[model samples]
Target: MEFVAKEKGFIAHFSYGDLHVSGDDEHGFRPFQLLVSSIAVCSGGVLRKILEKMRMPCSDMKVTAEVERNEEKANRVEKIHLHFVITGEQLDPEKVKKAVELARKNCPMAQSVEGSIVLTESFELVS
Candidate 1:
């Protein structure tokens, strides 16, 4: 990925599109937002695949993330809590929980931040 410096921040150009990154949200996506998003989205993607493989595919899944930051430590990210709401028919709660566990274990983004950022995942099934 290549990033071009702008007056306020940087814009990363990729095959998908351009991503604006900055310290301030007004300029673009904050660095912490991107980092947390990467972890949540990556985990969700892996979970989707795991569900399909387990024959428990969901019609929809939404991941909500809550981040904890330490103000004294340069506002560093301390923990991220991801709650997943899964909508599907005849879904097994136990299986979905297992899939979540597997996703957290396998997601590259989460693994990359392992031992540095604390991650927690929880899921609820809706028919």
Candidate 2:
């Protein structure tokens, strides 16, 4: 991964593609947004795999993240809340909860920021 400084911000070139990041929302994704997205997507992937291994058919899944930032000091992220909406047939709530727990424990991104930031997860199973 490499970043080239632009007039407004920077363009990060990765194996996948280029990402334009800036403090301005109109320009591109903010750095903090990227961090939140990484955590959410990482956990979502793990959760999906866990459900699949358990033979739970997930027709659709969406992971959304809400971040709380500290008002004082540097305004860093204080907490992240992940909400998952999973749609399927005959989805057991208990099993889905277990999968979410396992995902939180196993997600590398979540683990990385565990001590510094508070991470919370909740899920809804839709039939």
For all predicted structures, in order, the TM-scores are: 0.97, 0.95
Candidate 1 Cα outliers beyond 4 Å, as residue runs? none
TM-score of 1: 0.97
35-72 per-residue lDDT for model 1 (tens digits): 99999999999999999999988899999999999999
* lDDT by residue (tens digit), candidate 2, 22-82: 9998888999999999999999999999999989969999999999998796889999999
- Every model's Cα RMSD, please? 0.7, 1.1
Candidate 1 residue pairs that clash: none
- The C-alpha lDDT values of all candidates are 0.94, 0.93
